[model samples]
Target: MSEQSTTDSIVSFVLENKLKTILYTWAAGITGSLAYEWSRPIPGSLKIIHSRVYAQAITLAALGSVAAVEMYQATHHPDKVKKVDKHGY
Candidate 1:
């Protein structure tokens, strides 16, 4: 209800949106590579298995890193986040 609390809430919303945009942009960059590999035909069962395993490992690693960094920032320096004003100008 206080002025500072309202400001903080607005800031948090903006920061969350910004982080989502960044993550989505990163995902878009990877989508083409993923689509190409996914469209390919694997010659053997072993190769298919290896590809799936590798993809899973890589996705997990990347997500884990992003989560870790987000957690660290949220816990240690949330105040560093920026909030955009409501005007669309």
Candidate 2:
């Protein structure tokens, strides 16, 4: 097979694995949020469970944002990189 077709096949494989893809996206957000919260100093008076819930909410929001970008990327190719770069820099 040609190089372009091989690359296309790999992308197709990832797109087809719906459940794994979703878990990965959400996991990324959860990990990122947890790390962010860990590095900051919070009041000790706050309940641990409440803090955990807040962290999870932050993670969910991040995951939603990522999912939206991925959905937009799927509908609009070639332009995806431009959109990411515009936001990144």
Candidate 3:
């Protein structure tokens, strides 16, 4: 209804879709890594597989960090997740 509520709902919808969110993040990272590799003069000097592996590592690290933070919040401050930041918190 309200502008803030509409924005919040859209963000909530995106966050709720775990597979879509993860895939989007992974694809962004992988594409970025591959794009950089393709532009390098010595593309295969470091090995093409290394770029893929590094991209996967970065994706896993990001996902793992978010999961850890979410688990911590669920265990230590579960109520906060349900409450939106109303006063610019």
Candidate 4:
């Protein structure tokens, strides 16, 4: 297989796995949010660590809620799920 096809197949495999997608989403959201929060100055009473924890918790909660909703829709309303192309567009 060519390099492009290999890359595409790897991405396709990741997208096809719901658990992997959820874990990836959580990891990305948590790390991205933590980085953003850490870069900002700590507000009034909150410490830097507290702000980081808050960011991580909120990110995880939000992403978890979204994943739960998507899973629910997939299970109960399979027809409503959007289909993706081979490239995951």
Error of 1 at 1 (Å): 33
Model 3 clash pairs are none
The whole-model lDDT of each prediction reads 0.57, 0.56, 0.66, 0.62
Best by TM-score: 3
Model 4 / residue 16 / CA error / Å? 18
Candidate 4: count the clashes: 0
Worst 10 residues of 3 by lDDT: 7-16
Query: How far out, in Å, is residue 72 in model 3?
Result: 4.6
Candidate 4 stretches with Cα past 4 Å from truth are 1-46, 87-89
Q: Kindly list the per-residue Cα lDDT of model 4 for residues 18-59, writing each as its tens digit.
A: 566656665776577667766777763455466567656765
- lDDT, candidate 3, equals 0.66
State the lDDT of candidate 1 residue by residue for 1-89, as single tens digits. 45656645544554566456445545654564455556777655555565566565656665665566556657767787344478821
Q: Count the backbone clashes (under 3 Å) in each candidate.
A: 0, 0, 0, 0
**Which should have the higher TM-score, number 1 or number 3?**
3
Please give the TM-score that candidate 1 achieves against the real structure: 0.41
Q: On a 0 to 100 scale, what is the lDDT of residue 60 in model 4?
A: 70
lDDT of 2: 0.56
- C-alpha TM-scores of all predictions: 0.41, 0.43, 0.56, 0.43
